[model samples]
Target: MAPKAKQRRILVKLVSTALTGFFYTTTRPRLGEKLAMMKYDPMVKKHVLFTEGKIK
Candidate 1:
């Protein structure tokens, strides 16, 4: 592909990612929350146990 076309494609991809991030934060925030929960649920349990031990 030509350099100009490649640059345009990259720009389009960047815009698409930005729009998706905006929509996730504004319209579908629960999706981000669920993702966060999934990512952290395991660590949260471990953290709680570690903190409880530290208090002893």
Candidate 2:
């Protein structure tokens, strides 16, 4: 594979893995808050709350 194509594949895999982990955090609400703090955003916590049906 070309260098550019290989790099793209690696980037895609990394993004996919990170997204999977983020979704997993939603299943564990307490841990999700910690993970959200690590992300330096309030959105992750909001998403976790929404996913848990704590918010409409």
Off by over 4 Å in 2: 1-5, 12-37, 44-56
lDDT of 1 by residue, 1-56 (tens): 65642221111111112122211111222223212111112323321111100111
Please state the error at residue 7 of candidate 2 in Å.
Answer: 2.6
In candidate 2, what are the lDDT values of residues 1-56, reduced to their tens digit? Answer: 66652221111111112233332223333323322222322434333221222311
Q: Which residue runs does candidate 1 get wrong by more than 4 Å?
A: 1-40, 46-56
Backbone clashes under 3 angstroms, per model: 0, 0
Model 2 residue 32 distance off true place after TM-score fit, in angstroms: 24
In terms of TM-score, the best-performing candidate is 2
